[model samples]
Target: MFHQITVAFMLLIVRALAHDSPGGQVVLTSDETTTQESTLHVVQEELKEAEIIPTVIDDFLPKFILNVEWSSSNYASLGNLLKVKRLQSEPRITLREASDSSASLCASNMTYIVTMTDPDAPSRDNPKWSEMCHFIVTGLTLSSTSEEASSKVHFTDLQAIIPYKPPGPPPKTGKHRYVLLAFAPANGTTDPLHVSKPEDRQHWGTGKEGHGVRDWAKANGLKPVAANFFYAKNKKQ
Candidate 1:
């Protein structure tokens, strides 16, 4: 009976996500004490429906909830479309445990790395430069404390190895998927870590097929913990 209810509830979530306005604001409403795991599944389904899972990374199992706030009120909500101008600046990121939202996940001592990529670089149908590395930031640390439970804790010191480049899809290229992935030291090994920049944005320096986030993460001994993404296109197109 519980399984049946979960399935039913999930259907409602899917409908809500499907209907959310493209330009609508994404607000974090729940208290810090609990990050809803059900929401996590909703995000997972969004990725699958949008083909972000197979197109970029092969699979994803989120250990914690990743919240990305683009502006004061705008947050990354699944595959919602947004104007290119609104995403020019770097967005803030926060990670919270899925099991207990109140329980903060990032520790002061731990380091995290983030990567933003565009899998549908020129166009989804013909992606010669598939999986373009939009940006990469390392040396991120937890910057907030428990006292700010009402508010989310954001990662600090965004040291971008590959500086942020805003989405600029060519006119009439159709919509592009901008994916952000968060990684931590695999197996809790917290040594000073470094990620090599791709040879070029195109094919991630591997090939036309691309080296991709999964390959890069595995090579660096980092584990993908959480992810979020959005869609954008040249408004003129």
Candidate 2:
């Protein structure tokens, strides 16, 4: 009877977690996949020990629907995962020319607007420089000249909204959230969005009033499609 109950409980748990997709119909993240696999493995072990009829273990496997990764000259940060978790130590991004290298995005005919920011400078409470723009690109497509290969890795012809500038978290300030956001024209048109990069907004993006990410996206009918971010702490050097 105990064995039967134990087996029933295990089956219930496995069934509970057996959804078509993780995180409620959107997609399964890397960490989410790891957690699911770990749980499933445990359930399988429990079933084996319980002497219960073993079911197909692959029945609970999560399918990968989408994957996107962003990398720069300084640090390689995988999509959805925070930066501080990946890097050994905070890099002095200001001194180095950290341009973007490659991204494993969905192969599609789509334009993208990439924006990076530091939302922690001058401390989190009294953030004087929130969202310090690091890099911004626009008009990226599959056949774009920016990509080295006609490899269909999801980006091609592109424009730079804000040229690449490495992370510069000020000294004495707390860690900064370096966020890279990609937006697609909400209108879904292929027309070139000839937007001139704003000036004096390099640090914290306070240079131009009302011309920020939200404003520009509204004006150009842009919708955020993808994003990645990491944290960089204050480096005295």
Candidate 3:
């Protein structure tokens, strides 16, 4: 498997360094350190490219699993890294149990609000414009099907308060995480929500840090139900 190979490669690198040095004290020139760093970077990128890292538990917290699939056949499973072009269109979303996709959660007969946001607006290191709202759809509901289809939801059938904005990470800004969240009506209230778009994408229009889906959901009496996310970077980068 790719993961096994990556781990083996990393071990080999470490062993090589230890073997080359005396008494386990490895000394390297400036160029050697740069080369090692580059190699390590490649390993990290390969892990992401292989969709072996960045799980929902690792990236987004206090969240459940939501199945998000785009027309391009790319799925946002466990924070898999995807190309920006592949995510240009809105993805079909389905709410599922946090631990089981086949088993449905308590989302039946509930109207949901779906939202997408970028927690790393500029870059992970510097996210001054963090939590940028990318998409928001209200009046989303489950399809008219059997119990097995309880996870299915109608995304395109409703209107978006904040239209979908494709991921366009600036060149060399590292990878940005785009998270999709589904919120159900709070306190067993199923009335269609009259939500409005944020004044701006930055910080969900709060004009400050620490403002995003959680804040918006609290203000509108929406409860977090299920969520999913993906990573995207500029092609030029």
Candidate 4:
């Protein structure tokens, strides 16, 4: 009876060992499984971060200012001129010279304006519309003859027009283009126009009185000699 009991006990031990193994290999401990899961999660997070794209400032600059122009489409008249306002994302207008000058410096008190127009915008009768352009300008001064200053105004402080009402919705199935133009006086600081009201001037992102760059440029003597273009893509098919 004692020998029989010993054999049964040995068989039980072998069964338990086999159960703890998988595919003839020893099973991993709980801690080891947890560590492997954590490592995989970390690797996934790193891959996601690597896929993100970074936005660069120089990418926005136009290759040639001469390529800028106004749209010849009816969408220009869709919104009331008095009620038209600039987009929130694009707040400032700036101007830069084609060639650099040693004496020239970007300075504060510089003013700019931006305009968006879609010439190929589809009409009510036409279904297909061509792409449009967006513009931005920097490096404007008060007058043509004013001495160059080191501190220059950025697009943030540039003058713009913001209306009481929001801009009309974009057309269906068509991409809208806006042209941003930055202008400076050929001479310097002859007449400075205040584009914002006292209350409206304080807010940066809001559509305050001085919020539209295009409106501010029009109020001032700045001309649209140079410009950049951007096209808004269509999300729907």
Give the better candidate number (1 or 2) by TM-score: 1
Clashes of each: 2, 6, 0, 34
Off by over 4 Å in 2: 1-108, 142-157, 202-211
TM per candidate: 0.82, 0.50, 0.65, 0.33
Q: Compose the digit string of candidate 4's lDDT tens values, residues 1-237.
A: 874465445434433443554322111111322332332222222222222101100112221122221221111211112112333233322233332331232345644444443333342224133112233333344332222233334444543444211223254634433333445543444355444331232112234322334334444545443333333433342
Task: Tell me the TM-score of model 4.
Answer: 0.33
lDDT string, candidate 1, 40-145, tens digits: 6556666777888877876765656667777754667666677888887777776655555423435557777888888887888877778788888887654343
Question: Distance from true position, residue 13, model 2, in Å?
Answer: 14
Over 4 Å off, model 1: 1-8, 17-35, 100-108, 142-156
* Span of 10 residues, lowest total lDDT, candidate 4: 52-61
Better of 3 and 4 by TM-score: 3
- Total colliding residue pairs, candidate 3: 0
Error of 2 at 67 (Å): 7.7
Of 3 and 4, the candidate ranking higher by lDDT: 3
Order of candidates by lDDT, top first?
A: 1, 3, 2, 4
Candidate 2: residue pairs that collide: 83-230, 118-132, 141-156, 144-156, 144-157, 186-221
Q: Output the TM-score of candidate 3.
A: 0.65
* CA-lDDT, candidates in order: 0.70, 0.42, 0.61, 0.32
lDDT of 2 by residue, 5-71 (tens): 6546654454445343332112222243244333333333432432221211111211111122333
